[model samples]
Target: MKVLTANRLSDGIAVWYADGGWAETVTRADIAHDKAAEDRLEAIGAAAAANNEVVDVN
Candidate 1:
C-alpha cells in the first residue's frame, strides 16, 4: 500500500513508482515496507524532481 505518488512534470499527470520507474497504474506500484525503504524510494522521487520528471512526490 506504501507506494510513491507524484505528478509528471511535463503535464502534471498522476503517476506512481513501479519496478525502477514511474507508471500510470497502481497495479505497477512499488510497495515500501518501512521508513528506510520509503527513503530509498524517496531517492528516486528526488531524482525525478531534480530532472523535472515529477513533482510533489510522497
Candidate 2:
C-alpha cells in the first residue's frame, strides 16, 4: 500500500492524505493499492504543495 504525505502549511505538522483530504497522522491516511491511484493522490497533493499548503508531498 501507499499514501500521500506532507506538512500542514499553518504549522508544518506532518500530515497524510485521508478520506479525500489531508490528516495529521498516517493512521488516517487513505490507502492506495496501485500506481495509478497513487499518482492521482499525488496530483491532488501537488496542488496543496503549489499553494504552499504543504511541502515535500510523496
Candidate 3:
C-alpha cells in the first residue's frame, strides 16, 4: 500500500493526500493499492509541489 504525503508550505505541517485534498491526519489518507493508483497519487503530489502548496512529497 502507499500514501501520498507532504508538509504544508505555510506552516510545515505534515499532511496526507485524502479524497482530493491534503489532510492533516493519516486516518483518512488515500491509499494506493496498485501501481496505477500509486502513479495517480504521485502525479497529484508533483502538482502540489509545483503549485507550492506542499513540500517534501513522498
Candidate 4:
C-alpha cells in the first residue's frame, strides 16, 4: 500500500510523498492552488486509514 503526503517546509516549500518516502521537494511557486488535489489526497488518506484500522481490528 502507498500513501501521499504533503508537507510545508520552513522555506515555504511544499513536498509530496509517494510510494517511498518523499518523492521530491517542490517550491510553492511550482504548484498552483488546486482544490481537487486536496480533495483527492484527503480521499486517499481516508481510505488508507480505514484499511489500516480494519486490519488492526481483525
RMSD after CA superposition, every candidate: 1.1, 1.0, 0.3, 10.6
Arrange candidates by lDDT, descending: 3, 1, 2, 4
Q: By the TM-score metric, which is better: model 1 or model 4?
A: 1
- By lDDT, the best candidate is 3
The model with the greater TM-score, 2 or 3, is 3
CA displacement after TM-score superposition, residue 57 of candidate 4 (Å): 18
Candidate 1 CA-lDDT value: 0.90
The worst-scoring run of ten residues by lDDT in candidate 3 lies at 19-28
| 1-58: candidate 3 lDDT, tens digit per residue | 9999999999999999998999999999999999999999999999999999999999
Q: Model 1 RMSD to the real structure?
A: 1.1
Backbone clash tally (model 1) = 0
lDDT of 4 by residue, 1-58 (tens): 2235443333333345444233344322122247775565556555544654211110
Residue-wise C-alpha lDDT for candidate 1, range 1-58, written one tens digit per residue: 3889999988888999998888999888999999988888989999989998999888
C-alpha RMSD of candidate 2 = 1.0
Which candidate, 1 or 4, has the higher lDDT? Answer: 1
**Candidate 4 lDDT for residue 37:** 56
